[model samples]
Target: MSRRKKTSPAEDVVDLIALLPWYVGVILALAGYLLLHRIAIAPLPSALGPGALGNAMVGTMGRGLATAGQYIVPIFCLAGAAISAWRRHARRSLMDNVARSDGPDILDDMSWREFEILVGEGFRLQGYQVAENFEAGPDDGIDLTLRKNGEKYLVQCKQWRAFKVGVPVVRELYGVMAAEGAAGGFVVTSGRFTPEAEAFASGRNLRLLDGPQLHRLLKQARGSSSAKPAADIRATEQASNAAPQAAKTAAPSCPRCAQPMVRRTARKGVNAGQEFWGCSSYPRCRGTA
Candidate 1:
């Protein structure tokens, strides 16, 4: 899958907004401290005159308050920054957790909400207009629809964890694309795709985004706010294009590991007549097909 660079304004806003509470707390604390210090020392006599002892006491108190502010301000700033950064980090971490969760039975486990976000972010990066959580029909299979440069694209989010996304899913998506008259279709999954699924997608307008592709999308989404140099974009494009067509043409190996040349046939099915490649050591290997 080609990685697209698109910044998420929402995420950036969230990050910046998350710091507000900490900033407010620090300001309030500092103001209260300064106010209390002023009120406590404002009545003190000047120059340590007749009441030299009282003057000295007040002077000491003033010095202590000053010393406290000096120590407290820096500590508060550091604490505030750390807490703000952590809150932002935690939100990202939570999203990551949702993305990486093991789908139940490798077909129905993906958190739909997370998958929608991923698709929306992917389209945004690609400069496409993406509509999230779109409901076409009960069996429509499309979670999102994207439009770019006058071409319509349909998207299906399969948040599977273990089992490879098989040809059936792709076939269903293809049917949806035809019905919708879409220019292309995308099947984005947190899990891997089976060789049959990959093969089915080949020579078709359908594109598959597996786990690694999803990771790349996440990285791009996170990095979009920062502009990438032209040189960097060129280098990435070159690297992507430089990969051997053979490598790209190869069938899905182990979804767990993208090792190609692993094919097999099911013991029984209408597809039992068909051949597929799985991880060399399956069951125990628990690898993709």
Candidate 2:
């Protein structure tokens, strides 16, 4: 069997307009100038049978459109280049910060924009190229769009500190995931999630990242984004495995420790051989179902 070749990050992303050869935009601006100059020097269409007044109107309208194009085309060219440059710089800076950060704890202190940038960096670390959306409002239903291995995933970052993220947030993301045909969806919060939210996400193409998991991912991202000459394959693998505990979501948690519970049987009592849920921590936490 043949193995599939991996695409370099540089090969994964290309904006046709933004990455246009410098000569393209220069030629467009040059065309705009020639358009305006042509109108100023050339006579109106000799074939048009319009009388003197109609011809004057036609010439004025033609010149007006050319005048507007002379400004609009160059402005659009400049804007695309500017946006592409800004995105490149932002990604570089975000990766730099990721390598230097102690943990995701800093996420709590960051503004929404910074959090969004941090999230983009996190995905980029996982071999994804992220397209960010800054509107925190309820429009578009997606905050970050990520593509990896020819699959699209949507991510929403909720920095809500005081609330246990609820089911509606996850449900809403799932709904948009269906509409957008995303391979999977993730809702990340710098806080805990409600039991209902976890229940809703289980057994589906959804992953919920609580504060602790986010912390682990950031540490993983730091290694991946480091100045090291080569990729940290081990760190990325570890982080990907820990990103979402899909199996644990279906398992019951220990009531006392609030940690995942393990199944066990009573060893020496009348209840011997009877299976029951026990705390994974054992004697340290005697919690049971």
Candidate 3:
């Protein structure tokens, strides 16, 4: 995965803190309205008959109590909501950190049990009911089973890095899906897949989420409750990977610089079927192949 600066959970908490003032303002507004209403409704007789002064004094005291309640109640409500929002943000931030960290570098930082916990939390955030370290039965490659929408999904998570996932891994997942009659399967890895491995997965009812894809998933989970445009993220990743091929095809060769010439397969009228190769150094080298 391409390296990027990490976002901390403490930073997330700080963001939530910035929104607290708006919540406080809303609560204060409601409290002010209730306090005004209580004061307006407190009884005061137009004609000051005997004992009327005493009754008016008592009514003032009742209004004071009501005003205090108005202020205190809304303060409590705003505080509770702010706390809940902050906690949710913190949880999501921590999950994002786990998903984006370089697996090989961080693997040594966590014990096996902690690694399992992180994986389980990731699935749970995606609304899956996960069974961690599930037994591997014969022909079953599942390390975790997650059920959602009444369909069971067998998942195999590989924490391995510095390696590429290959065809046999996919083949085992296929066998497990067949044996358990799972609706579909997901293979999540902190590393990438070999081209052959990706080819093997294409026709099967399986989903492969590689390291970058996994980071994107965690980022989406951290998003607010709204649909996001996934196209941009996919496009960016594709463009980054395609840059070398694009560069090779666009430039002419410079013997000193070792850059290839711009080449085009079609150049002129009907029969001009191909075009390629002119040295970037041109007159100096006059090289063509």
Candidate 4:
């Protein structure tokens, strides 16, 4: 058995925070500094009363810890934020590159972590909230947990390049899904699946994505992402154009007649084609705005 490498406390803190969004890490950094700085500068208690010596000792120790932590904690948090940002960018880049590539050969070029990131990003683009398991080893089962429309899904990623992912991996994910109450599961690989693996996934809520299928998924996700900006622009334009109509339709009661106002256009004046509120009692109490 191989022993896990020992990490310093600071490194562990950074790793823990790096699993969160970069903005969360930044918030934690600010909060940690503010709170710790307040404690670091707090005045010591008086030593002239009962148990005052112990109180003074405790205060001194607390202040000492806070003094160091004020700087150290924020530094770790910011470092984690930086790491998160870098990973975010790397994941997007990996998906983009693979989606634009001609074949699945590019998938084999990535590390296991990169493969998992790619899978998570794909699910995220498809409107799922994905939680990547960065702490899991290569063969430790589920690499990602996905949630969408109030249902949970587990994903196992196999970055094996040389051999086909077999029934055992798919079976492991299915068992985990049952035990964890997952709604479904996916087994993604950078290689083909064995016939047994495909057979096992059949007739279940499990989906097995081999290398080519994964490539196609990334491509479709990229297409959908690329279409979003155009759709958003069109929606903004529609909203802007509808503002004048909304103003015209939402007219207050006529001040002169107390009747509902109707939207009318200036027919033959300098404001021709411009809309305004006209009284519903048009030929009698003519009120215009």
lDDT of 3 by residue, 1-289 (tens): 1112327544443334334544664565476668766775766666777778888778778777766766555555555456646544654555757555654345435443444455555777678887644222332456678899999988877666678888898888988898888999888777789898799889889999787776666656645222345766778889998998887666655555465654445467783776756566555655554
The positional error of residue 157 in candidate 3, measured at the CA in angstroms, is: 1.1
Candidate 1 TM-score versus the reference? 0.42
Give residue 262's lDDT in candidate 4 (0 to 100): 86
Error of 4 at 249 (Å): 19
| Candidate closest to the true structure, highest TM-score | 4
Clash totals in order: 7, 0, 8, 0
Candidate 1 Cα outliers beyond 4 Å, as residue runs: 1-110, 134-139, 228-289
**Alpha-carbon local distance difference test for all models:** 0.66, 0.73, 0.64, 0.88
Q: Which candidate number would show the highest lDDT if scored against the true structure?
A: 4
Any idea what lDDT model 4 has?
Answer: 0.88
* Superior by TM-score: candidate 1 or candidate 3: 1
lDDT for position 38 in model 2? 72
Which regions in candidate 4 have their CA more than 4 angstroms from the true location? 1-6, 136-139, 235-289
Candidate 2, residues 1-289, lDDT tens digits: the string is 0113435432222233355544565666567677776775666665655467787787878877876766666666665556556666775676566556777566677666666667777787788978765322454557788999999999988887778999998999999999989999889888889999999999999999987788778777767456354556767877788767665445698889899888888997899989889999988999998
- Per-residue accuracy of model 1 over 29-103 as CA lDDT, tens digit each: 567567656654555555565758966886777767765665565455546555665654554654455345543
Output the lDDT of residue 234, model 2.
Answer: 69
The digit string of per-residue lDDT tens for model 4 on 68-96 reads 99999899999999999998999889987
Global CA lDDT of candidate 3, please?
Answer: 0.64
For lDDT, candidate 2 versus 4, the one ahead is 4
What ranking emerges by TM-score with the best candidate at the front?
Answer: 4, 2, 1, 3
Q: Which scores greater on TM-score, model 2 or model 4?
A: 4
Residue 193 displacement in candidate 2 (angstroms): 2.2
